[model samples]
Target chain A: MRGYAEDKDAYLKRLRRVEGQIRGLQRMIDEDEYCIDVLTQVGAVTKALQAVSLGLLEDHLEHCVAEALAEGGEVADEKLREANQAIARLVRS
Target chain B: MRGYAEDKDAYLKRLRRVEGQIRGLQRMIDEDEYCIDVLTQVGAVTKALQAVSLGLLEDHLEHCVAEALAEGGEVADEKLREANQAIARLVRS
Candidate 1:
């Protein structure tokens, strides 16, 4: 299993919460909530999602990446590259 | 300025990379890239965003939340609540 596999339940739970927030956001839009209020909620949701992402990344680094490095060689190199690519994509976003 | 303020440049750079990945994904769709390949890229993008989110959350915890806790009292309570709410939203998502 992947490194994050162990914490999969926690990740799913976090994602579910984010899903709820999105629904709430949609509701606010439908209700014609004040623009700033809606924006504030949007910010809140974004921050929440970010937290989840960070936790997953940490798991990936500690588990998957760490294991791959211990093994060493081409696979390790590939894993490291994959991680860098992931980070690069993340930073760019 | 907040806890993440110190790493703001790094964050922005990461975000920019993600943005590029998104554009690449869009182009892939436009050019009719293989469905599986497109999905793979999408997965990559999601993971990337998650990394950025995690970094931001760490900063928030280490900086804003920590600061509030240090001060104590009503302000601390409010800050803690806000952080919990943020976490709740993230978990749900």
Candidate 2:
């Protein structure tokens, strides 16, 4: 089973919340909200999404990567490498 | 006029796109996409929102802050301080 499968519903809920925030951002712009105000909301949205990613990454490491590491072989190496790359992308983005 | 007022339509358009991305993220989770894959998409969405914030900040500085700095007084100092605080929030986020 996928690491996030158990928490799928939770993840979807968070994504929907983020979607609402994005729409709120549009309304702010349309209504001519202050620039800094919009920026502050955007920062909040960004942090929310970042939280989602971090959660998913944590799950992946706890389950998928953990299982692969326990197996002790090339598969484990590959999984670890993939996780590192994903972490790098998240950091860079 | 607010610095972003001129590009208000563009900003709204971008926010709509970000909204779409957030919805896509929900779809990904509902279908139980791989955790890493979900994380990657989340990172992309985060980057998109960050770009929007950066653009808004740039416009604010170019127009609103520029005008206040040109005036050269307490108003200018207040504007600069506000902008700096906004930037700090963005960086920390």
Candidate 3:
């Protein structure tokens, strides 16, 4: 479970904005918008998504991973392994 | 800048364990550990890290992006652009 519940309305509002951005991008593509402008918008979206992912990742490590590790032994090892793979993915991306 | 200061020690501790897991994986590779086992561990790490990223991303959207949007005009558009690019990157990864 999530250790904390972030503001639902705020979360949804941000997501909604992102959704609009995506649709705009789609429209841009349909209309053949300038390549650079499209790319620039793409970069913005990437950063925003990263920001969101980073928050979740931190919370999970602090709560889920920590709790599992506190339990010790195989669980700890498992959580450690899980974390490492996650980092690898982030780096690869 | 970060809007919040997460627990430093706790964050470091989790990172340290992940670091150890990586080193262990390296050793496993050197020793020709079972391919299946290595892949399994790799998967675990991926999930752990994803959890962390998600937490951070949520916070960024809620705080940074939202604040910028509330400020209005070009700032809102810029934030929206940034966020869209971020989500794109996340999906690609």
Candidate 4:
């Protein structure tokens, strides 16, 4: 099972909400919303997605990485590197 | 103006599609979709979001970072650091 398998439902639900927010943003743009206003919505969408990413990262660290570390050896090292890379990507985003 | 101001519409449009994909994943889950199938949708959503992130990053580098670099000085340094951090985060993700 995936690291986030336990919280799969929650993740999906959160994504759904973010998705709705995105749609709302598009509508705002279509309505010829003020530039800053549209940008604000964009910011909101970005934040929401970021939140989801953080949650997934936390879950991965708690479960996948933890499990890999417990197992030890090459797999553990790989997992650690993977986690670090994932974190770096998130930070950049 | 924001670095991505020129492609704001494109960014918004891509986000809208991602949002729809998220909704579709949710619906699939609600309908008792197979685990792997649902997970597949989740993967699709993740990839879509990543694509958007990459595009935004590209725009930032091409515009914001470039402009800042041209100005030179403290602002340029700040922009460079910000871009590096952003890239790191993306890699981690």
Candidate 5:
């Protein structure tokens, strides 16, 4: 099972809400909303997406990475590398 | 007119693409995609949103804020504060 399997529903819910926010942003633009107002909304959506990333990262570390580390082999090394890379991507994003 | 008025269509196009990305994310979750892959896609979407924010900020600075600053008064101060606050929000996100 995937690391986020247990919380899949919650993740889906959050993603769907973000989808709505994106749609809202389009609406704001259509209405010629002020740039700062639009930027504020964009900030909110970015934070929500970051939160989802954090949750997924936590679950992956707790389950997938932990399991691989317990196995103690090349797979463990690969998993650790992948996790770190994802983290770097997260920080850079 | 809003600062982004000249590029409204471009902004809308970008936002629609982001909306599509959000849908793609929901699909990945439904299919139980790997955590790292999901995280990578989230980063892509986040970067896309950040690009939009940056575009709006540039337009605001070039047009709205610039206009207020040219006028040179309390309105200019208010615009500067608002722009700075928006920048802080972007950085924090």
Candidate 6:
């Protein structure tokens, strides 16, 4: 959903890189790599994943949220609530 | 930064609603709206803002991060470190 399938190639590429980074991290863990080095890799992975989440969220807002707003009713309010909860989760996390 | 200035209208619109939601939440607090009602609204606003963050993060990875990776050197490693730090912040938050 959320139009992600439409951009499968690009998404998959990014995800693959992320997956590689994850494996690298696993190796670091197994090898007892320096804590700072491992943590640094972790931070990169986090940002990368966050980037994907953000893309999906933006697309949802621009398309779905905008459409709901255009309809003009409880939809706007409802979408607003949805958006708020999402932000909260991001911030909370 | 982060290309947000390019889409001023759209970003502003989303931000405005988010701002309004924030104000509404403040009012709810002042008026002592039902705790659940206020919290629910808060959640909505949180999700909305997170959407914005996610969008920016995605762009960074696609453009900046990807470019960094392509350079194929210390840049890739450095960008990876940066990405990890960013993700850590997101997750920590």
Which candidate comes out best when scored by TM-score?
Answer: 5
Among all windows of 10 consecutive residues in model 6 chain B, the one with the lowest summed lDDT is B61-70
What's model 1's overall lDDT? 0.61
Question: Per-residue CA lDDT of candidate 5, range B4-82, in tens?
Answer: 9999999999999999999999999999999999999999999999999999999999999999999989999999999
lDDT of 2 by residue, A1-93 (tens): 889888888888888888888888888888888999999999888888888888899999999999999998999999999999999998888
Q: List TM-score per model, in order.
A: 0.52, 0.97, 0.47, 0.59, 0.99, 0.48
- Candidate achieving higher TM-score, 5 or 6: 5
lDDT of 4 by residue, A1-93 (tens): 566677778877787778777788667655655433444455555566566667667777888789889999999999898778667655554
Q: How well does candidate 2 reproduce the true complex, by DockQ?
A: 0.89
> DockQ: which candidate is best?
5
Candidate 4 lDDT by residue in tens digits, B15-74 = 778877777867765565544345445555666666666766777788778988999999
> Which residue runs of candidate 5 sit more than 4 Å off their true CA positions?
none
lDDT of 2 at B59: 98
Error of 1 at B69 (Å): 0.6
Per residue, candidate 2 scores C-alpha lDDT tens digits across B1-93 of: 889988888888888888888888888888878888888878877887888888999999999999999999999999999999999999888
What are the per-model DockQ values? Answer: 0.04, 0.89, 0.03, 0.15, 0.93, 0.07
The per-residue C-alpha lDDT of model 4 at residue A12 equals 76
State candidate 6's DockQ.
0.07
Kindly report the docking quality category of candidate 5.
high
The sequence of per-residue lDDT tens digits that candidate 5 reaches over residues A1-93 is: 999999999999999999999999999999999899999999999999999999999999999999999999999999999999999889877
Chain B of candidate 6 achieves a TM-score of: 0.82
Give the clashing pairs for model 5.
none
Docking class of 3: incorrect
Superposed by TM-score, candidate 2 places the C-alpha of residue B36 at a distance from the truth, in angstroms, of 1.2
- Write down the worst ten-residue block by lDDT for model 5 chain B: B84-93
